[model samples]
Target: MKLTTSKGARALVLVALVATVGACGLPRSGPNKREIFAGSVLKQGDAYVVTVNSRVTRATAVMPAFGFGSSFRNAGVVGSDTINAGDLLALTVFENVKDDPLLGNTGQRVSLLDQVQVDGQGYIFVPYAGKVKAAGQTPDGLRQILTKKLDSQTPDPQITVQRLAGDGQTVSVSGAVTGQGVYPIERPTRTLSTMLAKSGGIAIEPAVAIVRVTRGGQTGKVWLQDLYENPGLDIALRGGDQIVVERDQRAFTALGATGAQSLVPFESQTLSAIEAIAQVGGLATSLADPTGVFVFRNEPAEIANSVLGRKDLRGDQRMVYVLDLTQPTGMFEARDFLIRDGDTVYVTEAPFVQWTKTIGAITGTAGAADSLASVGSSGG
Candidate 1:
């Protein structure tokens, strides 16, 4: 019985072989059996605009609001004189009031006293009070000083001294902005955002905007994104403050069996595996093997060297992780995976798929040739 069964199997195998050969006879010209599959792998030299997320640590702590009358706002005062020698005074005096005899004189009826400018040499020129010192004083302070100086000569003198230059204060604006320059600050306190606007705001590409402040030789870096996301991060600006807006620096490559394989920019420091895949235009349906998708990454050289010396390698080095999208649980790990720059993503094709494609192509070509020959014979 065993011998009979063996013989029967051999006969069946021979018959199957003969049927196959007879059905598809050997052609005069060899068949093009090269498998043609969909999808293209990504290669180097591809350009992509990568978004970079930069975390800028504050070089200096958030400075407390300077109290009123701080040195930063110190200004020279001008005396009650028309000569160019007095403190630089910033005072708002009343002048040009309606003439009234009860107030004082008809032409000088308690007019509004406007603030006047004083030179650095501690001298201010007044119409009637000659030159006076006006450095190191506010508008009110300068007004009192001028009144006393003029009263000694003339009682109830109609005079006023105000600051023409705003405390002689200026602030610098730099970094990623349309216009970066020094702007005269009239107010004592200004917000970081306001200063940025004065300097034409952040640059066009502000994914990694950094606003830096340097005051009294102290420097601080603030994230523009943080300021936008959290309004509390926006700090105040002081006179003589230097602001800098820096761009970000971090990127990644997108490739393999996906539409538009290019470098994708991300402002976020780390990119989820799903996000990276989406940036490359998702996976190709015809050629991507969902279960065989893999991201190849190399460990840092220093770490690799250390591991080599110890003969203990970490999984990240020389390790190929197979991502099985078919399994529901795999989605969690896929989402958690972080893509780094220079990473290579490979989407493999199914085995035996090439064989089917080659067979199909050959069958199609043969059918076309046979139909052409039959038509020729009928025409003859």
Candidate 2:
């Protein structure tokens, strides 16, 4: 009988051989890839250099809660506010004798009841208390003035002043909220966060929300989560304060060899490149090129010039920032560099990744040749 290897046995031997060859050809990163990745950075003249220290210290942000933003003020320690023009006041005046003509002579001792409007002139007309100054006075303050004014003229007058509405009483809660209403801004609801709570906290999660405060035509924004984390960001709101709770649209695209390659949210209003790396799930350990990390952004001409250490920077400048994670100090610099909205963080693939494909092709060809040789032997 002719000697012939069984098909199953031959198949097993071929698989084992391919496995061995595949393991041998698995790629290893060499010095050549590192040089090529870093060499491009060295060759670029227009690129800016943001050292780690600059990244941490150079970034700045304007604070919120109006009035140049006082963190201390936002923590809910505000003094009493005086009423202003266009405010509404409700007055209840009582006298011992209901027979008084000025009081309408109602049977009950509580005679005068009036809802007074504080006009643009900052005055409110009263029956016994004529043109009482309602503006620039607290409810208590106005009560004292009204009682004192009618003290001798009216019989044992008792005055009650309730502030119906403040001049700039309404606060606008818009964007991602359960209810968007023009709420009456009162004493307890004078804070940005307190007002948000009155309108039903937040419809969306604070982690992915931005709280924008606009007052007197000036606007400032803070991360909603940051406001929760740092109470100082939860500012005391002013009259006509517009609070917008928008879903965070600002994201940075993470590409290349990160753990997750996608658009990562800028959870915080201000993000450093180092922080962004964590958000994007860091580098892909097996395939990432440590020396080939990069951030791409457009820079203003002056800023580009200052960062690149050159005076030639001008007009519509864009830059690719190279970061070599292989270096001990490179990571520290990345921590300080501020990441703007729409930035691209790219981590290149190790050169070995490409080499593996090439080696894989050669191995596949070799395997085919051996299979052909086996078939010829079987035929013979």
Could you estimate the TM-score for every candidate?
0.52, 0.66
Task: Name the lDDT of candidate 1.
Answer: 0.52
Number of the top TM-score candidate: 2
Model 2 ranges with Cα > 4 A deviation? 1-89, 98-107, 112-156, 164-168, 177-179, 200-209, 223-236, 365-380
Report the lDDT tens digits of candidate 2 across residue range 1-380: 22354454455666766677667744433223344345354565444434334442363211223222554354453334567677777778777775644565556677546567888778888775688777778888988988888887877778787776654467799999888988766777877888888998889877678788887767788777777777666677665778899987878899878878788887765687778888878888888887777777776776666666678867746666777766778777777777777788877778777777767766785677567657755776
Instruction: List ranges where model 1 is wrong by over 4 Å.
Output: 1-136, 156-167, 172-182, 186-189, 197-209, 214-219, 229-232, 240-247, 267-270, 293-323, 340-380
Task: State the lDDT of candidate 1 residue by residue for 73-134, as single tens digits.
Answer: 23222132322232244433233345553223676545443455566676666645568665
